[model samples]
Structure formats: structure tokens, C-alpha cells
Target: MSKYLISIIGPTAIGKTALSIKLAQHFNTEIISADSRQFFKEMQIGTAAPTQAELAQAKHHFIHHKSVQDQYNVGAFERDALLCLDELFKNHNIVIMVGGSGLYVDAVTKGLDDFPDVDESIRKTLNQDLETKGLEHLQKQLEMLDPKSYGTIAIDNPHRVIRALEICIGTGKPYSSYLNKKNTNRPFKTITIGLHAERAIIYDRINQRVDMMVEEGLIDEVKALLPYQHLNALNTVGYKELFNYFSGAWTLDFAISEIKKNSRRFAKRQLTWFKKQEEAIWFDYLTPVDAIIKKVHSTINAEN
Candidate 1:
């Protein structure tokens, strides 16, 4: 029998966790999480990690499995996830991978794009610029160096901006040139299932999720993680907004509003990213679980 990996991808709060759990139960296999933010052990309510009951329904890997202090990146996650999948495919013919982080999902299904080794000095210079000149300066620099990336990638993310600038500066070429390369061959076949909804519905879901997180102690979660706010792992949407509030930069109401707005924007970006996936099979977010299961099983049976 040919092994297969079913990837459940969608924007935040679009019922990915619920759907992934249901799918995992149906497949009688475990799940691998590609959601980068949920990997940190400290972030729960803000990252909207699976509830204890949901986790009990399915065995999951890479969720709350790392400390914020650890130097984790997509490269490290790729290596670790592949090893986990190797062990999983040993027993199960079908494994489920789910998350909103498109890059991490791509790393496992396809592979990381190749970029020439950049000079360390370039990164150091960029870091210095970020510290002294501020993020806007670097953002503008990326805009000038790689407008395509500025338009596509999360340019508001300092790490992404610095990465693009480093590559652009090191190779003297636009950073976007290194993206969307040929995927590496994999031992198992992958079936990508994308869940989507109307724009207004998605935004409403995002807003409701943000409110849910807040009521579930998202502020306290951020308060507890305040000491580690400087860490890259904490530089995320919900936590960052709360952190700003904690710092007196914004009121609690404003921070909560910002979280909702940023989450909506993030969802939009996710949709844009997933839309480029030519091989993806999409369904409305409200699609019946039985129907999706039938579709997946039929696809698997046909492939086998």
C-alpha cells in the first residue's frame, strides 16, 4: 500500500483544529502540527492551541513541544518533522499534517527554497540597523531591494524583513528570485485539503476567536510571558499586541482590537498564500466532515 500524508491547511480560527482532529480520528493516525507559533510551550490561549479534550482525541506532535528560549526555526522544524513522519509512516499508511503556517507546511510537503550562503556581516549590519534605525528603516530597505517580497511576505515581521534584506544584499539580486523552486522528491504522496470561507465570514471568525482568546485569559497568558517578550517566539500577533498594552503603549481595548485586526490581516495573507497552491483541494469551511472524509478516502483509494 502506498503511504499518504493528508495536509489540512486554512487560515486561523477557520476550524482547522477541529477538522484536523476529526480527520485524524478517521484516518486512525496521529497528527503533525506545522503551526509555528503553537510549537512554543508557553503560548496556549494566544496561539489557540488544542484544548486538552481535543488533544486527547488525537495524538499530536510538535505542539507545545519547545521552549520559547530555544533557537527554533523553520529549518529545524523541517528536519524534526520529517523524522517524526518517518517513524509514523512505519506503522500508519496515512498520516495527518495540519496548520496555518504555510511555509512550514511547504517545507514538509515540498522543501525549503534554496538561497546562496549569505555573509554573516550582512546580517550583523541589518541587526544594527534595526536596533538603531528602527524597523521602518529596514522595511523601507526591503521595499527598495525586493518589492515583490515586500508585497508578498510578512514584511511587518522583522525576521522576514531582515532575511530578505540579507539575501538581497549578499547576492545583489532580488530575494524573491530564490522562491518557488522545484520541490524535493518525497517517499510518500501528499493530499492537500484547504478549508476556506467568504471574506466576511473569515473576518468574523477571526474576530470571534480573538474575543474567545481574551475571555480565556489571553491577557494573563501574555502577562506571564512578559519577561520573555523580547524573545522572537513571543513576537507574534496576539501576544505582541498584549505586550504593547502591558508596556503602556496601548490600552487593553486597543490591544484587543489590534489583535482582531492583525488576525484578520493574517487570515487574508494565508488565503493569498494558499490560493497559489495549484494542487490543493479546497472546500467551504462549513463542509460536512463526512463528505470531506469520503472525498479524502476516495482520493486515497484511487491513488492506491
Candidate 2:
């Protein structure tokens, strides 16, 4: 029999973990989590990492493996996850990897773009502009410099947009121009299965999950990590919304509302991102999960 890697991905709070656990138990194999936030042990509640029961069900790797104080990015994640897979593959041919984080998934399966380095002064200039003139000013600059990126980037998210503009201005090359490169080859075969549902259903689930997170002490989680709020890892959706509240930029109600709104928007973008991959096989989250699992089983059997 041939072995392979099964990657399950979907929007936040769309039941990716439950499905992954089921598959891991079925294959009797370990799971490698690609959740970027869950890697930080300090971010347990906010990241919705696996519970104790799920952890005990199957051996897992990469969950709660880092700290918010550490500077871990996709480059580091790619190195670590591939290394874990290398050792796991020695005994078992099939390993399950699952997460909603698009960049990490792409990094492991397709590899990251060879982004050119920018001078420190370039980022410093942009940071100064952000503080003095605000992100709107830098956003307008990015739109003018790289319209393609401007169309795809989250305008409200200043850091990413500015990063793109910084590269464009510093390297004299459009950010999108570099993205046209090809994917790097991987040693293992990747079978990507995406979970999806109707927009209303997915959005409602996300909102409900946010409300549950609040009831489950999400505010306290953010409070505990406030000292590390400036870290890139803490810049995620759940934490950032509450950070604005802490900074007095918004009221508690407003912050909660923004969390739901941003989370919905993020899920939409996730769907859009995953939809672009022609190889991804999607299944509705509500329908009989066994059907999809059987399909996966058949597909794997055929490939084997």
C-alpha cells in the first residue's frame, strides 16, 4: 500500500478539527497542526486548539509548541512541519495535517515566495508614515504603487499592505510580480480536502463561535497577552479587536461587533483563497461527514 498526506482545511470554526480527529483515528496516524496561532502555548483559548480528549485520541504535533514572545513566521513553520513529517513518515505512510491558516498551508505544500529583502530604512520610513499620517495614507500609496496588490490586500490591515508597498518602493518591482513564480516541489504527495458550507451557515457559525469565545474568557486571554500585543503572533483577529478596546479606540460592544465582522470577512477571504486551488476537493460541513470520508478513502485507495 502507498502512503500519503491528507490536509483538511476550512474557514475558522468550521469544524476542521473534529473532522481531522476523525480521520486521524481512522488512519491510526499522528496529526500535524498547521494552525499558526495555536502553536503559541499562551494562545490556547483564543486559538480554539484541540481539547484534552482530542489530544489523547491521537498523537499530535505542532499544537501549543511556541510562545507569543518568539518570532515565528511561515518560513520557520515550513521548516518545522516538514521536519516533523519526515520523521512521522518513517513508520506510517499517511499523516493528517489540518488548519485554516492559508499561508502556513501553502508554505508546507507549495513553498513560500522568494521575497526580496528590503532595506531597514525603507520599513522605518513606512512605519513613521503609519504613525504620523495613519494607515490610510500608506494604503493610498500602496494602491498607487501596486494596484494589483491593492485590490487583493485587506485595506484596513495596514501592516500587510505597507509591507507590499515597502517592497515595491524599495525594490522598484511590483509585489504581485514576484508572486507569479512557480510552486516548489515537495517530497510527499499532498491530498487537499477543504470543508465548506453555505455562506449564511458559515457566517452564523463564526459569529456564534465568537460569542462563545467571549463567554469562555476570551477577553481574559487577550488581557494576559497584552504585554506581547505588539508581536506579529498577537496581531490576529481575536486579539487585535480586543486590543483596540484596551487602547480606548472602541467600546466593549464595538470591539465584539468588530470581531464578528472581521471574522466573517476573514472566512470569506479564506474561502476565496482556497477556492483558487483547482486540486482542492470541498465538502459541505453539515452534510454526512462519513460520505466525504468514504470518498477520501476511495480516492486514496485508487491512488495507492
Cα lDDT of model 1 overall?
0.91
Candidate 1 per-residue C-alpha lDDT over 74-137 given as tens digits, one digit per residue, 9 for 90 to 100: 9999999999999999999999999999889999999899999988999999999999999899
The number of the candidate with the highest lDDT is: 1
Compared with the true structure, the alpha-carbon lDDT of candidate 2 equals 0.85
Each model's C-alpha lDDT? 0.91, 0.85
Which 10 successive residues of model 2 have the least lDDT summed?
150-159
TM for every model, in the order presented, reads 0.97, 0.92
Cα TM-score of candidate 2: 0.92
How do the residues 1-304 of candidate 2 rate in per-residue lDDT, one tens digit apiece?
A: 6658899988888999998888888888999999887999988777888988889988989999888888787889999999998999899988999988777888888888888898989989888998899888998898898887775555556678777987999899998788737578887888898898889999999889989989999999999888998787787888899999999999999999999998888887777667777888888887577887798888888887
RMSD for each of the candidates: 1.2, 2.1
Q: After superposition, how far is residue 126 of candidate 1 from its true place, in Å?
A: 1.1
Q: Which residue segments of model 2 deviate by more than 4 Å?
A: 147-159
